[model samples]
Target: MLIATHSGKFHADDVWAVAVLDILFPGSQLIRTRDAARLAEADFAVDVGGVWDAAAGRFDHHQKGFDGARQNGVVYASAGLVWKEYGGRCVAQLAHECCGQELPPQRAQEIAWAIDSDLVQYLDMADTGSAKNAPGGYGLSAVVSGFNPTWIDEQMAGSVEAAEEFRLNQFRRAMGFIREIIINAVKYRVGALLALDQVRQAERLEGGSVLFLGNAALPWSSVVRNEMPEVLFVVSYSMNENRHMIHTVPVAADSFKARKDLPKAWAGLRGGELAAVTGVEDAIFCHNNVFIAAAVSYEGIMRLARLALAEPDPRGA
Candidate 1:
C-alpha cells in the first residue's frame, strides 16, 4: 500500500493522516508529491487529491461541495476523514502496541470517540480555519507548525537538496511528536480502565462522605463523581512519605470549583495551625483555594475528611 500526501509545506492534518496510515497499514510506502500521476498511482491519497470518496480510499476535504463533518458538526479534514473510517481499529492496535492490552470492541469505540473529541476534532477544526473556543495559539496545530524549517536556517547548508531535506526532516519530527501523543493517549486510557476496579473497591467502604484508598495514585475522581455521586471527598494514603491526601470532587474535570470544598477556615492553613483549626492531628496543609488538603497520617486525613464534610457549605446547611 502507498500513503500519499501533498509534497510541500505539510499541515498538521495531512501529517496526522499519514501517521495514522502508517499505523493502520504497517510498512506502507509513503510518497509526498503533487503530481496527478503519482497521486493516482497510490492505493491511498490524503489531503492532496481533492476527493472525498471513502470507498476509493481518497480523503481530501477541500473539494467544493464536500460537506463532511462529525456528529458534533466540526468539519472533517483529511485526518478526521481517515479517522472516521479507521480510528477504532487503529486505536485498538495502539492500545496493544502502547499499553500491551487488547481493547474490546465497545472499549475501542469509547477510546476512538474520546480521542476524536479531545484531539482529532480540534485538529480538523484548526486546519479548516475555524475560530477556536479557547484563547488561540496553544494547540496541536501551532506545535506542529513549529517543526517547519526556516528558509534562513536551511540556506546555510551547501547542498542543493537542503530545502527538500529540511521539509522531510520537519515532517518526520512532527510525525514522531504526534505518534508519541497518540500512543500515550491510548496507554493512559487503558491504564485508567485497569484502575477502575481499585476505585470501585474503595467505593464499597461503608462510611461518611469520603472514600479511602491505600494507593494515592488511584484515579478515583471519575468512578466516584460520575458513578457514585454521593462521594464528596476521597482520602488516599501515599506510601512514599506516609502522608495522606484529601480531594474534593470538582463540578467538572476542568473546573476548579468543587462540589464540596474543604472548610473555608482550613483554606491556606499549614502545619500545626492547620491541625489546630481542623482539630485533626498531624494535618500538614490545605490549599488556599480549598480544592485539596494534606495530612501526615491516614488516620488524620480520614478524620479531616469527616470534619470537612460536616463543615457549613454555601450550597446547604
Candidate 2:
C-alpha cells in the first residue's frame, strides 16, 4: 500500500505525517515539488491533513482524502490523535523535537490556545490579504472598508519595531510597462481615439484594460483599465485604394482581427489587417519608418510591426 500527502509548506505536521506513515509502512518514498510533473507517477494520493486539537477535542477536517486512506489502510483514527502525538506546538517546538528536546509547557499551552481560539483564521486572513483583494472579486474598496484606523494608530504609537511592507515587485514592474506604453502612445498621437473607445469597452468589461491600435493609416495604440491588469492594442491601415480596415489585439491569446470597410468614413477604420503578435521582447520597432516603442516587454508589438514593415508597399514595392 502507498500513502501520499501533498502540501505547499513543509510544516511540522508534514514531517510527523511522513514519519508516522513511514513507521506504518517502511520503505515508502516521500516526494514533493511545486511542479505537477513530479506527481505524474503517483497512482494514489492524499491531501494534506489539517491541524488537530486534542485538549479542546476539536479536529480540523477541512482537508479531504485522509479518512478514506485511513480506512483503506485500517488505521481509522481522527486528526486529533495524529496532531496530539506527532504535531509540534510551533516552529520552535518543531525544532526542539527535531533536536531531541522537550517542548516547554508555556509554548505547548500557547499552541493549544491558538487552536481553540481559531488563530488559524487570522493566518488565513493574512494569506488572503497577500493576494491583494483578488480573491472573491474583492477590491481595494472592500479592504479599506474593513481596515481599522485605530489599529494603525496603535501600531505606529507602540514601542515595538515595525517592518516596512510594499506591494509585490512584479505588480510594480507591470505598471511601469503600462505607464511607458500609455505615455508613448500619447506623445506620438498613436491611438488617442481608439484608446478612448477601448476605455469605454473596459468600463463595460468591469474595469478591465484593453489595448487598441491601428486605424485608417496609423500605428498601434494600447489602453489599460484603471483597476484591472489587462492591456488591449489596436492596429488599422489601408490595404488597397478602395478598402480601409480595422484590427484589434487582445493581450490574452495574442489574437487580432480585420473586417471590410463600410460605407461611412469611419467604416474604413473598422476593419484593419489582424495578426497574432508573438515573440516580442523588450523593444518594438517599425523597420520601414524606424518608429520605436520601448517597454519591459515589447515582443508582441515588435512582431506585429515587423510583419507590417515586411509587406510590400501597395503603391510600389
Candidate 3:
C-alpha cells in the first residue's frame, strides 16, 4: 500500500490524515508528490488528489464545488474528511492496542465523535481559515505546522532534492507527534468510560453526603457533580502521595463554586496549625479557597469532612 500526499509544505490536517491512514494500513509506503500519475498509482491519496471520495480512498478537500461540513457547520478539511470515515476504526484499534480493551462498534463511534468534537474539528477550522490558531500559539494545529522547514532551512539545504528530503523527514516527525495525540485521546476516553461504573458504585458515607473512592486517580467529578446530587464532598485515597484527600463537589462542570466549601476557619492552614483548627491530629493542609484538604490517614480526612459538613456556609446560615 502506498500513501501519497502533496510535497513542498505540510500542515496539521495533511499530517493528521496521513497518520490515521498509516496507522490503519500498517506497512504502507509513503510518498510526497503532486504528480497525477504517482498519486493515481497510490493506494490512498491524501490532501492532494483534489477529490473527496472516501470509498475510493481519495481524501482531498481542495476540489472545486466541495461543500462538506458537519451538522454544526465546521467545514471539512482533509483531516476531517478522512476522520469522518475512518475515525471509529482508528479509535477501536487504538483502544485495543493501547488500552487492552476491544471497544464495541457503537462505543468506538461514540469516542470517535468525542475526538472529532474536541480535537479534529479544530484542526479543520484552522486549516480552512474558519478559525484562528489558539491564543498564545499553543494550539495543536500551530504546534504541528511548526514542524515544517523554514525558508532559511530550505535555502541552507541548497538543492530541491535536499530540501524535499528534509521536508519529508519533518513530515514524518509531525505524523509521529499526531499519532501520539490520537493514541492518548483514545486512551483517555476509554479510561473514562471504564471508570464510570466504578464512580457510580463508590462507597457513600456520612449519610450519603460524602463519597469515598479508593482510587483518587478515578475521574469522579462529572459523575459526582451531575448524578450524585446529594454528595457534597468526596474523600479518596491518594496512592501517589500515600495520603487521604477530601474534595468539594463543584456545582457544575468547570465551575469554581462547589456545592459546599470547607469551613473558613481551616483556610490555608497546614500541618499542626490545620490539626489544631480541625482537631484531627494528622490533618495536613487546607487550600485557602477551601475546595480541597488533605490528611495523613483516612480517619483524619473523615473527621475533617464531618467538621466541614457540620459547619455552616459562611455566606448564609
Candidate 4:
C-alpha cells in the first residue's frame, strides 16, 4: 500500500508521521506536498493540514488562533483542506495532535487511533439524524469525532496475550487466502500489501491440510473480534485513475486452505448468508468504497467472493 503525506505547510507532526510510516512500511513511499496535483495519484494520503496553521498565521479548522510569536508563524491547518479538496478516493487524516510523543511506536498507535476515530465520524455522518443529535453540524461533528484522545489508551489496556492471539489468527486467515489463490501449486507470482505493520506470518501451506484449529481475530472498525472456527472476510476498495484500484482485505479464521482450491470456495461465498452458526456470532462483512466515501455491511462473505472474482488473476501477470 502506498502512503502519501500531504500538507499545505510542514510541521513537526507531519515529520513525525512520515518517520513513523517509514519505520512501519519500509517499502512504502512517502511524499510531501501542498499542490493538489501531486496528491491526485496517491493511494492513501494523510492530511497534516492543521500543522501548517501556526506557520500561516491563519485560523485552523479547530478555530485555534495562531500566534506569530512561536518561531515564525507555523500552523496546522492545510492538511485538512487538502484532504477536503483533492484527496479523491483513499484519504485519511493523521491527527497527530493528540499523541504527545513522537516515538515511532507511539506515532503508529496514534495513526491507528486517528483512522478509527475518522471511521467513527464517517459512519456517524453517513447515518441519518446523526447531524441533529450531534453538537454541531455534520461537518463539525465529524471533525470533533475524529479527534479521539483515549483510543490509544483503550487499545493499550487490552490484554497483550489476547491481542497477539487475535492478530495471529487474522494473519493465518489472510495467509490461507493468499496461499490458496496467489501461491497455489500453479506457481503464480504473488504480492502482498499489509498496512499498520500487522502481518505476522505468510507461510506456505504444505498440502490441503486443515492443520490448525482455533479461533482467530477478525479486523473490524477499531478492534479485532475473536470469533471461533469460521472466518469473516472484509474487502474495502478505492479506485484511482493512475493506480487503477486499491483494495484492503482483512480476514479471520481457524485454518488454512490450499492455493489452487480457493477459487471454488471464493465463488461459492459470493452473496452467501453471513449470519453466525454455533461457534460464531455476528458474522458479517463490511465493504467500503473509499472513492465514493461509502460503506455497506453484508450478511455473509459474498462481498469478498465478488471482489476476488473481480480481481484479475495475477497468475496471468
Candidate 5:
C-alpha cells in the first residue's frame, strides 16, 4: 500500500498521522507531494489530499465543509482523523510488540479512549490553533518544528536535494522517537491499573489520618485522592534496608497546599538536629517545604507522621 501526504514544511499533525500509518501499514511506501493526481494514485492519502473519505482511504480534515470533532469538541486534524479510524488497533499492536501479550479486548478499548482524550485530541487542538487544556501553548508542535532545516543550515547542505534528504532523516528520527513515547506511555498506564489493587488493600488497613503502605514503589497519589480522601499522611516502607518515607497528601492535583502539613518546627531540619527536635531518634530528614520526611524505620516514619499531625493548626477555630 502507498501512503501519501504533502511535501514542504511539515507540521506535527501530519507527521504523527504518517508515523502512525507507517506502523499500521508496515512497508507501505510514503510519497510526499501536493499534486492532486499523484495523491489520488496512492492507496491512502492524508493532510493535503483535500478529501475526507475514510472508506476511500483519504483522511484529510482541511475541507471547508467537513465537520469532525472529538467528544470534547476538538475539531479533527489529520492526526485526529487517522487516530479515530485505526488508533485502537494500532495501540493494541504496539502493546503486543512491546510485550509478548495482547491486551484484553475491553482493556484495549479503554486505553484507546484514553489515548484519544489525552493524546490524539490534544494534537488536534494544537494543529487547528485551538486551545483549552494546554496552559503553555508550545508543546509537541514546538518539538516537531524544531527539526526543520534553517536557512543557514540549508545553505550549509550545499544543495536543495541534500537539504530535503536531511529533512527526511529528521522525520524518520521523529517517527522512532514518537513510537518510543507512545509505547512507554501505554505500558506505564497499564501497569498503574494493575497496581491499584495494592493501593486499595493498604487503604483498608489505614486508620485515623494515616495510611501505611507495605511497599512504596507503587504510584499511590491518584489512588489516595480518589479512593481514600480521609488519608492525610502516608508512611511507606520502601525496599531500602534502612529507610522509610512519610508524605503529606496534597489538597489538589495542581496545588502546593497539603491536606495537612508536617510540623513547622521539623521543616528544613535534618540529622541529629531534626531527630532531637522531633524526639524521634531514627529521624533522617524533613524537606524545607515540609511535604516529605525520611526516617530509619517504619516505626520512625510513623512517629514523624504523628508528630506532624500533632503540630498546631494555625487555622483552628
Candidate 6:
C-alpha cells in the first residue's frame, strides 16, 4: 500500500492522519508529492488529493465547497476526516495490541468518539483557523509545525532533493511521536474502562469508610470520588513496590484536597518515627502533604487507617 501526502511542509492534521493510516497499514510506502499521477496511483491520498471520500481512502478537506463538520460544528481537516472513518478500528487495534483485549464494536466506537472529542477535533480546529494555538505555542499543532525545517536548514540542504529528503525525515519523526500519543491514549482509556468494574466491587472495610483494592495500580480516585462517596480512605497492596498503601479520597476529581486527610501528627514521618507515632509496627512513610502513606504489611496499613479515622479531622469537618 502506498500513502501519498503533500510535499514541502506538514501540519499536525496531515501528520496525524498519515500516522493513523501507517499504523493500520504497516509497511506501506510513504511518498510526499503533489503530482497528479502519483496521487492517482496511491492506495491512500491524505491532505492532498483534493477529495473527501473515506471509502475510496481519499482523505482531504481542501476541495472546493467542502463543509464537513461535526455535530458541535468543528470543521473537518484531514485528521478529523480520516479519524471519523478509521478511528474505531484504530482504537480496537490499539486496545488489542496494547491492552490485550478485544473491545466490543460499540465500545470501540465509543472510545473513538471520545478520542475525536478530546483530540482530533482540536487538530481540525487549528487547521481550519477555527481555533488558535495555546498562548505559549505549546499546543500539539504548534509542536508538530515546529518539526518543519527552518529556512536556514532548508538553505543548508543546497538542493531541492536534499531539502525534501530532510523534510521527509522530519515528517516521519512527527508521525512516530503522534503514533505514541495514540497508543498511550488508547491504553489509558482501555485500562480505565477495565478497572471500572473492579473499582465498583472493591472490598469495603471499616463500615465502608475504607475501600480495599487488591491491586494498587488500579485507578480508583475517580470512581471513589464520584460513586463511592462514603469511602474516605483506600488501602491497597502495591505489587510493584511490595508495600501496602493508604490513600485519602479526594473531594473532587481535579482537586488536590482530600475528603479526609491522614492525621497531621503522621505527616512526613517515616519508618520507626511513623510506627512510633501511629503505633503500627510495620508502618512506612506518610507523604508530607498527607494524601498517601505506606506500610510494610496489610495489618500495618489497616492499623494506620483505623488511627487516621479515629483522629478528629483537623479541619473539623
Candidate achieving higher lDDT, 5 or 6 = 6
The C-alpha local distance difference test score for the whole of candidate 1 amounts to 0.83
**What TM-score goes with each of the models?**
0.90, 0.18, 0.95, 0.20, 0.87, 0.90
Residue lDDT tens for model 3, 7-39: 988999999999999999998899999999999
Sort the predicted structures by lDDT, highest score first. 3, 6, 1, 5, 2, 4
Report the lDDT tens digits of candidate 2 across residue range 1-317.
34444533222222333333343345666544323444444432322334334343223334445342222232212322333343333323433433334546654444433341232222223332322323453432233223222455436645432211111122223223323432332223323432455444432211322233223444333333232234322333334432222133333334232111111211112112112122333322222222222223234443443444344444351
- Which run of 10 residues does model 6 get worst, by summed lDDT? 129-138
lDDT of 6 by residue, 109-128 (tens): 99999999989899999999
lDDT of each: 0.83, 0.32, 0.93, 0.30, 0.80, 0.93
lDDT of 3: 0.93
Pick by TM-score: 2 or 4, better one: 4
Once superposed on the true structure, which residue ranges of model 2 sit more than 4 Å away at CA? 1-3, 6-28, 31-86, 89-101, 105-107, 115-119, 123-317
In candidate 1, stretches whose alpha carbon ends up further than 4 angstroms from where it belongs are 157-160, 203-206, 240-242, 279-281
For model 3, what is the alpha-carbon lDDT of residue 136?
A: 71
Model 5 RMSD in angstroms: 2.7
Query: Which of the two candidates, 2 or 5, achieves a greater TM-score against the reference?
Result: 5
The deviation in Å at residue 68 for candidate 5 is 1.0
Model 5 steric clash pairs: none
lDDT (Cα) of model 4: 0.30
Model 3 spans > 4 angstroms off? none
